[model samples]
Target: MQPAMRSLSPLTPSDYHAHGVCCCGTPLLQHFHERMMALFAGLHGPETVSASPRGQDSPLLLTNLRLFDGSGAPLRDNVAVRVMEGRIQAILPGDAEPEGAEMIDCGGRVLMPGLIDAHWHTTLAAITQAAAMTADVGYVHLVAAREAERTLMRGVTSVRDVGGPAFALKRAIDEGIVAGPRIFPAGAMISQTSGHGDFRMRHEVPRGATTPLTEQERQGVAAIADGEAEVLRRTREQLMLGASQVKLMAGGGVASTYDPLDSTQFTERELRAGVQAADDWGTYVMVHVYTPRGIQRALRAGVRSIEHGQLADEESVRMMAGEGAWWSLQPFLQDEDSNLYPDAARRESQRQVAEGTVRAYEMAQRFNVNTAWGTDILFNPQNTPNQLRHLAKLTRFYDPLTALAMATGRNGELLSLSGPRNPYPGTLGRIEPGALADLLVVDGDPSQNLDFLADPARHMRLIMKSGRIHKDRL
Candidate 1:
C-alpha cells in the first residue's frame, strides 16, 4: 500500500538549506515536496510519516527545566541547557536563560540525553522473509529512511545496530539523506552453517539437476565456514562493507530455526580468527551467546562483548570480566504488550527472549558484570510503536536513573567513545560542556517517579539531537 504525503511549504528558510536536497528557493521546495511525497509512498500509508517543524521552526531556549543526565544522580531543577552549532555550549542553573532566544519554558520538566538503542535491526523488510531482501539494494535504501526516523520519533538519537541486511541502512543515515539515529552498524553477522544467523537457504537450478547457487545467496549471507582462514575472510568482508564493528553468531538463538541454543557452532580457532580480523581493523567483535560454551569460547577468542547470555552463571560472568568483555542486556520485562508476537513460533521466540533477558539481568546484578543496556526490539516494526514499554523495566525493578545510564553513558563507554578532551571531537555522553546536544526534556521528575519513563510520548515534551529539534511539545 502507498503512503499518503502532505504537500506543504518549508517550515523555515534554514530547513530548506539543512536538507541539502533541492536547490534553494520556493521552486526547489516544490520539488522537495514532490520528492518527499514519493518517499512517503514508498514507506507505506501517509500516516506512517510526519514532518516535524524544521530548523528555526523549533524554539531555541528550554528555560526553567529539571534535568537528569542519565547518570545515577540527583535531579537538578530550574536548569537551562544552551544548544548551538549542533553541540552543547553550556548547562547552567535556572537564572542562565538567554534573552531573545525564543525562550521555551520547560515548566520543571526533566531533561536528559536523547535515548540510544544499543542493538537493533532496521535493514530487514520482515524478519522472517529477511533473505528476500538480499536481491534489493534500492528498495532497502528507500525503506531505511522511514525506519530510522520512526526510531527518532520514539526518542532514539543513537543506535548500535547488530548485523542484518548489510550496511545500506547505516550509510543512508550517515550520508544525511534520511532521518534516524546516529547509527553504529556491524555490517553482516558471521555464522557457521546451521548457526543462529543461518536461518534459511534456497537455490535455483536447472530442472532434474542439482539446484544451482544464486550469487545473491552466496554473497548476501550464510557466510558459514569451519576453518580459521574462512572465518577471518568473512569477518574482513563485513568490515570492507563499512562495518564499524563485527558480530558473530557465537551460539544458537531463539530467532534461528536451524540452530540450537546450547550448541557451539564455531571452533575456538575460528572464533579467535574472527576476533583477530576485527582487532586488526581496530574494531570490536560481539557474540550472540545464550549458553555457557559459547560464552566461554567468546572469552577465549578475545571478543569484546556478549549478548543474550541466558546460561551465564558465576563462572561465565567472571571469565568475561577477566577477559575485559562487556555484556549488552535488554529488559523486555516479559509482559509489556507481548501479544505483539501473535504467531506460535514468534510467541515461543518471545518466551525465549523474555527468559534470556531475565537471566541476563539477574547475572548482571549478581556478579556486578560490566554491562550495557539496550532494547533488542525492532525485529518487528510494530514493536517500534511501543518502544517506551521497555523502560518499564527501570520503574519496576531497577531505579530509573540507573536505567537511563545503561541507555546512554554506559553505551558510549562500551562503544569506546573517547572523552571530551579528545583532539578530534570525541562523543561525550554527559550533559557537560562539549557533549553532543542529544537531549530529552520530560514533564515530570523521573528519579523519584519512574513511571514517567514509560509514557515517553506524553512526558517527553522536548527532544533535541545535536542541536536539531526533532520533536518539541513546549
Candidate 2:
C-alpha cells in the first residue's frame, strides 16, 4: 500500500525564534524561516525557486558562464556553479548536468563573487550632515531600510558598517523581515569627548554638564567616553549588543566640526582599553585615523584595522605592513559629487584628505601593505546610488582586475579578522566551492570593462545572496 503524504503547516514567529540559532550558534533560523515564507508567498519567479520546504538548503545550478571567482586570477570561460544549502557545492564543467537541481542558463554572462563594502554607515543615510542630525530617529531607520535594499540591488551583497546604530537593522535583515545585505555591525563608534564621533551643537556644553547627551549620542549612533574605564565600558556595551568588531575614533575627521583633520584624539591608554575589551570578546578594533602620528599611536594600542589613513607617511605605512593591520582606504575623488561641507574649515579638511588619496595608495603599494576598498558613503542619500562608481575610481591606481579583487577578496579577508565573533562564517569574497553563495552575474566582463558595474540595474543579470535570488534579469 502507498503511504499517505504529510503536509507541513506555516511557520509562526515563535517557532522561527525557537529554532533560529544555527548549530554553530549563528543566528540563521530567522533567515531560513523567511526563505520558506518567500516560497509560500509565491514571490520568487520560475527562474529562481526555493529548492526545499525548509528553505535552509536550496540547490541552484548555473551553466555556460564566464567566471572571475574573485581570486584575482585569470578569468575562466564556460564555467558552471552549483550552490546547495546556501553554499557553493561545486565548480563543475559547463556542459555537466547536475541531478535534482533547478538549472538556469547564464547565456555566456560573467559570474563573480558579490561586491563588499568594508566601510559603511547604515544609520547616517540623510542627504546632508545637518539633515541627518535633525531627522527623526524612526524616519532615519525607515530610510535606512530602503537604502539597504537599493545597495544590495546594486550588486553589493554584504557590508561591514564601521559606525552607526546598525544592530536593529542587522537583525531585521538577518531575520528576513527585510531584503538587504548581510551586515557586520560595529555598533556605536567609541569616541573621546569632543572627538570625531562627537556631533554636538556649538552652544551645547560638553559631557558632565547639566545638559543631556546629543540626539545622536542618545540614539546610540556615537558614544563619548573620557577615560580608560569609560572607554572599556562603552566598548564592552557594543560587544554585548552583538557587534562583530569595535570602532574607535583615534584621530579627527573631516565631517566633525570641533576637531581639525590633523589632530589626534584619544589617549594611548584609552585606546588600549577599547582594544582589550574587543579582544576579550574574541574580536578586534578598527580605528578612524588619517595622520601618521595617529596611525602610529593606534598601532601601538593594538588596533587591527586603520580606516582612512590617507595622510600616513612612509614609516607609518611600513609599521602597518609589519603589524599585518588592514588599510581600509576610500577612493575619494575631487569631483563635484564629493563631500561639500557647509563650514569652511570642514570643507578644507575634506580637501586635505582628498589630496592625500593618491599618495596613500602609492605608500600602500611601496610597503606591500594589505589594503581593502570601501565607499564610505555617509550623510548623502543622493550619492549613495553612486557607490559602485567609487570602486571604478580604483582603476586610477590599479588595473580593472586588481581593483575588483581589492573590493572582493581583500575586503573579505579583512572582514574575517573578527575571528570567532564573525556572524556569518564559511568563506566570503570568492566563488570557490564551500564559500557562501553571494554572487552576481554581469552582462559584460567587469575585468575588461568596469563601466558595466557602475549601473548594476542595467548590466547585472542576476543577484544572489546565500542561495536566495534577489534579482534575476535573465
Candidate 3:
C-alpha cells in the first residue's frame, strides 16, 4: 500500500562532495576531514574515511580575559564568560574548565561591552549633501550597508538612528540578511515648516505649492508638519511604521539652510502633540535642539531625550537634570577637521556649537544629569569611519573609563527610554549573566591607552554580537 516504502539511498562520497555537506548535515568546513577524504576518493582509489565525532550544540566559552563590565567598576583579571542562545549564561573563573563547550582563549586581552552610538543617521551614507541628493535610492542603501558593516567591524555593536529611512535596514539586520550592528530606528524626523530637518533647496517652493515633495521627503527621510494636528499625524505615521522613538526638530541646526541657530522651530503645543503621540505608543520623543528656549519648550512638552545641548546654559542643564531627562551630546570641537560647513552662516553656527561643548559638559557634570555620547557624523562618509575616535574625544571632559561608560552603559539607559518599543529587549552595555552578548576583545587596556581604539582593525582582536562571532583575529 505504501509502494515499497521508497527506500532511501545512503549518501555516497560523490553525493557528499556535490552537496558540500558532511556528517550530520553540517557545512563541509565544520567537518573538513570528511570532505577532504570524499574529494580524494572521488579522484583516487576507494579509500573510505570515517566521520569524526560531532560535538554537541553547546555554549561558547571565552576564557583568560580581563573584564570591564561597563558599570564604572575596576577591571577584573582572569575572567571567563559563557554565552548561550545569544545571551550571557555565566561568568566563571578563568581556570575553571567547562565541559562540552566551544572554547576561545582570549590570550589575556581586555574584554568589554561593545560601543553604542546614541545618535546616528543611516541614510546619509554619502560623503556630501550634493551626492546624497543626487544618488539613487538603491545605491544609497548599498552604501549604507557597507558603512554599517564597517561600523560593526570597528567595535560598535549597536546604534540608534535618530533620523533616516532605517526601518528596512534594521529589519534586514535582524533577519540575518545583512551583517551590521543592531539598530534602533527612528523613522522620518518630524519637522515644522522651515525647521532643521527641512531640506528644501533655496529656490524651491514650499510643500503643497507648485512643487512636489523633495526626494528626501518622499523617501521618508524627513517629514514636514505645520500645526499640532499635522505634527500628531506625522508622529503617529512614524510610530505605525515601526519607529522605536520619535525625532522632532525643536530648534535650528547647522546643516539646514532656512532656520537660524538661535531661533526655536516648533511651538510648545506642536512639540507636545508629537510627545503625546509617542507616549500613546509607549515610547518617547527625542528632539534636535540646542538653545535654552528650545530645550525648555521640549522639556515642558515631555520630551525624554535632548540632543545637542551644546548651546544650553547652566539653567537649562539643571532643568534637564531636574526633569530627569537625557542629554545626548556630541563632542564637537573647533579643531576637528570634520566639522567644516559649506557656507558662512553654517560655519558660524558650527563654531558656536563647537565652542559651547566644554561648558555643556561642565554644566551637565555640575547638575549630575544623565548624559550620553554619539558621533552625529553626518554628510561625511569619510568621517563615519572615525566613530570610535569621536568617542575617544570625550576624554577631554571625562576620564577614559568614564567616556567608555558613557558610550556604553549610559547610552543604553537612554535607548531604553523607548520602554516597550525597544526592539532588542535585554540588558545591553554590560557583561553579566543576563545581558545580551555584545562584546569586544582588544589587544590592550583601552583605559590606559585610548589611542588603542583609534585603530580597531589592529587593536581589536575579537568582535562578538548576539553570541555570533563576526571578527576573530585570534
Candidate 1 vs candidate 3: which has greater lDDT?
Answer: 3
Q: Count the backbone clashes (under 3 Å) in each candidate.
A: 4, 0, 0
Each model's lDDT comes to: 0.66, 0.82, 0.81
What order do candidates take by TM-score, descending? 2, 3, 1
Off by over 4 Å in 2: 1-56, 209-211
Give the TM-score (vs. native) of candidate 2.
0.88
How are the candidates ranked when ordered by lDDT, highest leading? 2, 3, 1
Name the better of 1 and 3 by TM-score. 3
The residue pairs that clash in candidate 1, if any, are 3-44, 3-45, 3-46, 4-46
Stretches of candidate 3 exceeding 4 Å from the true structure: 1-57, 209-211
Model 3 lDDT per residue over 1-474, tens place:
111111123434554354444456656564675555443322222221112111112477888899988876778987798888788888898876766567777888888998899999976743467777888887677677767767888889999999999888788678654557899999998898889888887777645655677788888989989999999999999999999999999998877777898889889999999999999999999999999999999999999999997999888888999999999998888665456766888888888988898899988888999999998888787788677888878888888888888888888888888899999999889999989989888987766747788888788887888877666666
Candidate 2 lDDT tens digits, 397-456: 888888899888888898999999999987889999899999898987766758887787
- Best lDDT among the predictions, by candidate number: 2
Error of 1 at 106 (Å): 1.8
Enumerate residue pairs that collide in model 2.
none
Best by TM-score: 2
How many clashing pairs does model 3 include?
A: 0
